[model samples]
Target: MTQKYRNYDPEFKLYVVKLMELDGHKMTDLSQKLDIPYGNLKRWKTEYRDQKKKEEKEAQNQLLTASEYKEMYEKEKKSNVELQEEVDILKKAMHIFNQEK
Candidate 1:
């Protein structure tokens, strides 16, 4: 049985594959040279392809209507401002009450 080397990160393994591709090296030669299993390279390549497809689909998904988005943002801004004002009022009340001590 072939001896195993230290475990490498999956990300690093993928990076190795990318670099090998860019270098115009043959996959068979790389598999032999890098001591990585051919199956791992094929699986990683497939996973990368599928992930890219999913990302593209998500990016092309429809966004909310401009008016609806604007309305939601304004509501959130108003709520935040109201909360800040209430906090300021409570602080002032506490300061005044403390001064009577």
Candidate 2:
């Protein structure tokens, strides 16, 4: 007979990752305490780290620094604000027309 594994939520996984990062609990200790497989926990830790690095690299490629991001964000936000104001004005005009009917 095969043993069953339980599903862990995002919070649970995050907790485990924190413990692993802290290095206060050994992998086997965590496995015993959490009733998770030690090998799986190790794999998850490595995958989490690799994913974080990949995401940071992607963010860097997309936007490098805070000032650069703020500049781009401000420009984009200004354009969006103009578009939204135009939309609101059109909506109000449409409402006035509708009410006049």
Candidate 3:
């Protein structure tokens, strides 16, 4: 006779890992209680930890340093001032043209 294999969804795996973390349950205890293999539970926990570390590293890489943020702010402010000056000049030209008409 052949034994059937059971498949678990991602939510179930995450819930099992969280249970172990929040309840301070041992791998053997959870495996017996949940009817899952001990090795599978251990592997899921390891994979979850590695994934979190990778995400944190990516987030750190995407953040700008203080000097970079200041430089970007200055550039945007200068561009905005230039645009306002152009608008003021156009309004003055329109006023002069209207008076001469």
Per-residue lDDT of candidate 3, residues 1-101 (tens digit)? 99878899999999998888777889999999989999899999998889889999999999999999999999999999999999999999999999998
Query: Which candidate order results from sorting by lDDT in descending order?
Result: 3, 2, 1
Segments in model 1 whose C-alpha atoms lie over 4 Å from true places: 1-26, 34-43, 59-64
C-alpha lDDT of all candidate models, in order: 0.81, 0.87, 0.93
Model 3 accuracy (lDDT, Cα): 0.93
| Cα lDDT tens digits for candidate 1, 25-73 | 7667877888888777777667767887999888867567889899999
The numbered model that scores best in TM-score is 3
Best by lDDT: 3
Compared with the true structure, what per-residue lDDT tens digits does model 2 show for residues 1-101?
Answer: 99897788878887898798876778888899888998889887998899899999998798558898799899999999999999999999999999998
Poorly placed runs, candidate 2 (over 4 Å):
64-101
Clashing pairs in 3: none
Q: After superposition, how far is residue 98 of candidate 2 from its true place, in Å?
A: 44
Question: How many residue pairs clash in model 3?
Answer: 0
Worst ten-residue run, lDDT, model 2? 17-26
Considering only N, C-alpha and C atoms within 3 Å, which residue pairs clash in candidate 2?
none
- Taking every candidate in turn, the Cα RMSD to the unseen true structure, in Å, is 5.7, 7.2, 4.4
